[model samples]
Target: MSVLIQYYNDFISRSADPRVKQWVFMDNPLPTLAIIAVYLLLVLKILPLYMKNRKPFNLTRIIRLYNIFQVVACILLIYMYLTAGWIQGEYSIGCAPVDWSNKPNALRMVGTFYWLYCLKGVELVETIFFALRKKFNQISGLHVYHHSSTFFLTWIGCKFVGGGMASVPSMLNSFIHVLMYTYYYMSSLGPEWQKKLRPWKPRLTICQMIQFTILIIHSLSAFHPECDIPKYFMLLYLPNLVLIFKMFYDFYKDSYKSKSASLNHHQREKKIS
Candidate 1:
């Protein structure tokens, strides 16, 4: 372990910049692919057993557990974010701008990034539970895509983008998770309670879209003369986000339209019958 740490430190030292070092780490490709493989295997193995039992999906318990996990994880992430500032000798949240390429700070950032990446892996349990409960309809393409992509993206961020423009999206994502998780906790009880609270699911989706947009813009900004990010990777990053945003928007619109149409159809059928 000590030798591995020394090797990582030496590699970080020799790299041109934090982003370059991160890219090297992401270039490994093996760990992320392995995770996806395990996720698929687990889903295949458990889904049939869940179907055979015919158990009703238990939303309440799932929500409670999810809420607990998010609340705790959010708190811990916030603490780490603050500590990173302290390590940089910045006493306040608004102190000196963070230098993403600074070695000590970059190392700390990578460590936190790893924590967040592992959290994404842990979150796979959400999908597994859904599969087990036979709530397959809820497991849409967006759902699976987001889960799988986030795991890989977080891995890439930790390994290749930990200290550069890419970190902005990561930091924003953590903040959003705080809000998203709290909303989930409140909405978990039942429809009656959710009606009273009137939580904004659309707003959450909008926030997510905004986050991706910011990330894309930030990646582009690295093209300026002083920025160190390679042109090739920057070019690669932008188009993927465009596709991601379009997919999320379409999913949002379709979901609302489908729900409304279902309600209208139900009313019409009642009148005709």
Candidate 2:
């Protein structure tokens, strides 16, 4: 155990992106691990036990506020990435490697990556809310896995390569999240509003599917011998990307395709009658 710890500390000291090593939660994995540990303990044990005999809190206003904050944060992230280089054609879509320099734009990109990592940590609160409201159904394996893995994954990305190809996925994800959180915000208004937004739910899922597909392709582009951003990052990241994509695909089929098929069968029976 001591040997392993020594090796980890040495590896991080040598390989971490120097610009971000001094940033909050960027110095080591322990803080991030602690956050995840607390999140799991609360949602899986403490919150559930606390809410067992109590009435669920009506968090309509709180949810709406949180959704609004997510929307704004995503917008800011999009702006940060865009102005940094993505929109100005400064980055290669196929394979842009990290700058790793002290140039102003490069540092700005580092800041963007760090903030995105921080945002993932903040997102764990969504699960906390579900637990507090006794919405255990929302805390499915996919939900927990996605939240936990993404938080750790972003931390790794920021600590190593803070810019380049990574910014592409994070930026695109922010755009999709803006749309998603907007839907959540509108749906939180009331039951009638939720009914009105129902059609958009499947559409949102389609958008998520599209995002993951693009990410898979983009991640693979890094493997070209000349791309220069470590292939191992993609090796670690792509599998998780593929896994999450498959999960989302399953959800889409179960949630929408089956319902569509059933509805079509009902229509056919009505016609026969």
Candidate 3:
């Protein structure tokens, strides 16, 4: 296992950007592409099998496992981040690089990113569960697009962008997932648990929005003279963020609008009766 980890690490390190010795550990294009391919294939193949049977998919086990996995992963990442800081005697609060070529720090960042990248693959199972349960309507274009795009973009980020700026998003995302997965796990317990946890979904969405906004700002800050990061990469990061923000906003509006309208209709009927 250690050897395999080392090999993976070496593979990513070699693909690091030439200019900055800050190696991109999660950036390997081949593996990412392969993973995406496998995901698509699985979706195509398995979805139909489930559909034919017309059976409800019990996601209790998967959700429980996912919840545990994310919590543990988040803890490990936080520990890694802190350990790296302590060892190097360098730390920054937000998304700023302490130094580029700090190997241990870079490796830790890479490992975290690697897990996150794998998590994207694991997340594909969500769609599968939805499909199996025959909740096809829930599988929106936004759902598919976000899942697919993130897998590729994260790979790109790991490949092209490394160090403090890149690690910031991963760290924040992991923290959010810890909460998000926990909510999912509890809600999976059944309807009784769901009512008590009803408020959590909005909070999760809020946190997600906040995280993206912070990431956008952090990426933008790279253009500052004092920061001295590449301009092209920063520019690339901004437009994607803008699009993501817009998408999330649209989703929130649409989701709430429908619910609000339904409630209003119900109230009008009650008043008339």
Candidate 1 vs candidate 3: which has greater lDDT?
Answer: 3
lDDT of 3 by residue, 134-182 (tens): 7777677677767777887766655556556666776787788788888
Root mean square deviation (Cα) for candidate 2: 1.4
Q: Tell me the TM-score of each prediction against the true structure.
A: 0.73, 0.95, 0.79
139-243 in candidate 1: lDDT tens per residue? Answer: 777777778878877776566555444555666777888888888788877798688666387778888888888777666666777656655545656776787
lDDT of 3: 0.70
Could you tell which candidate, 2 or 3, scores higher by TM-score? 2
Model 2 misses residue 182 by how many Å? 0.5
- Give the per-residue lDDT of model 2 (tens digit) for 91-148: 9787898989998788899899999999999999999889878899989888898999
Residue 159's lDDT within candidate 1 is 60
Q: Rate the local accuracy (lDDT) of all candidates.
A: 0.69, 0.91, 0.70
Those runs of model 3 whose alpha carbons end farther than 4 Å from true positions after fitting are: 1-28, 44-50, 86-89, 93-95
TM-score of decoy 3? 0.79
Candidate 1 wrongly placed segments (more than 4 Å): 1-27, 44-53, 57-59, 85-103, 197-199, 231-236, 257-273
The global Cα lDDT (0 to 1) of model 1 is: 0.69
**What lDDT score is found at residue 2 in candidate 2?**
100
